[model samples]
Target: MSDMANNDLEKYAKALDNAIMKYHGLKMEEVNDTMRHLWNKTYQGTDIDGIKIRSDVEGGASKRSYNYRVVMTKDQVEMDMRGRCSAGQKMLASIIIRLALSDSFGQNCGILALDEPTNALDVENIDALAESLVDIINERKNHSNFQLIIITHDENFLRKLGQAEVMEYYWRVSRDSRQKSVIERQRFR
Candidate 1:
């Protein structure tokens, strides 16, 4: 009876591992595809060719954890992005990963909200983010429930994003004299 139980437990573990591997493959494909699309549009002349997600298993057979790292391919050489990339690059990668995760798992929700997405991004990267967002918007325009909500204090970034979306007006929220929140619709210049 003990041997039978051990065999069953091993089978269960193998099944669970296989399932995890399958999910990991799907996630990797989604992330890579998203990066390919966004990176090309964001970085025009940069030597960074693309990025790949590397996963490693840690701990013993009974207890395992997966560690993922973003590796950049430049000049046909691969480099890990941890502690080696600039702040803007890291921010861009973070945004891309979020976008990929949303794309893979949030299809039913149909909404993506970004708060202070331009933080740590340079002027050029800000514009690139706007363009990438516009591309995403266009891709999801056919979905009736898809909506994007962006909250930021940077009016310049908002203007750039509005231009990308071809919007004429945006809602501005501010505190009134009595310290109450007021929402107003303002035309984008």
Candidate 2:
């Protein structure tokens, strides 16, 4: 990877970590340690033959690469390898990388947006993601320097989070020949 790409990755990782730590009232180091463990458990010893994470840069920019190895003992008698892409693994990596970057910079980022982040995630993975997000928000609240805009259709998840944190709820409804959206903002008194 080029220096610029590496730098960008580093920055992203630090930002993500800082956001999580600030929102969740947890240490940055602790979040990183948990991420590492989660990564391993999510993919290790699975039926995964091979895994690759590649980023395509626009305008002739250098690409970035990440690799993962998986081994199955009971399924095979010998070594097996294949190239595949796992969305779950990629999502986790992206979150970890961004967190790490945020943690290092200590700079305030304007907004953090997550679009359907929990999509396609299994129950266990979804729980992990929720925990991570809660931690991030808690950390931000503690530091008073973070803002988040999360878009999702998961009502259950939203309700769970809303109970613990102040949130702005928006609902879009369509009526006869008209479409309108309502926003309800809440804050701790």
Candidate 3:
């Protein structure tokens, strides 16, 4: 890469780093730890193996990888992203990365919209994820202007969330007889 290209790349990286720290109030080390923590919580059982975040800069171009695998008895096979992991695993990883990179490069918006966030997760995993999200929100509540809005049809997941004061924030979307979408906010606490 040319000097100009390298300069631009560095500038972008620096800006991204600044935003991440400013918004999330977490250092790079903390970010890694958070990722690992979330990953472990998300994949707590069964054949799903391990996860590793790798950064490599060969020559000029650079890349990052979220390497994960399935630990079988005879052989452990590395997944090619769209290769082996289940839907829930993929969704969990995506959420972790999205939250971790909550800088200008990612979703720095004050609002986080998760459509059917617990789609493929099992009961235990869903509960785990809900608890983790609540922890994250509480930790960052006074620090940033961020909110998590989850749209899911799973009643069990909603109960697992256990958001006590969610009455003011929760909303229900439904279709009327005309098939028009109608949004109803929670009227009871």
Among all candidates shown, the one with the greatest TM-score: 1
lDDT (Cα) of model 2: 0.54
Q: Which candidate, 2 or 3, would have the higher TM-score against the true structure?
A: 3
Better of 2 and 3 by lDDT: 3
- lDDT against the true structure, each candidate: 0.82, 0.54, 0.64
Give the per-residue lDDT digits (tens) of candidate 1, residues 6-87. 9999999999988987998888788788877777787543857877677888986568788989998888898998887777
Q: Give candidate 2 regions above 4 Å deviation.
A: 1-85, 165-177, 186-189
Collision count of model 1: 0
RMSD of each: 2.6, 11.8, 7.2
Worst 10 residues of 1 by lDDT: 43-52
Candidate 2 structure, TM-score to reference: 0.49
Tell me the lDDT of model 1 at 136. 88
Please give, for residues 51-170, the per-residue lDDT of candidate 2 as tens digits.
222222233113423243332223333232223335765565555555554554445764677777766666666666666677667767656657776787776666656665544454
Counted clashes in each candidate structure: 0, 31, 0
State TM-scores per candidate: 0.83, 0.49, 0.64
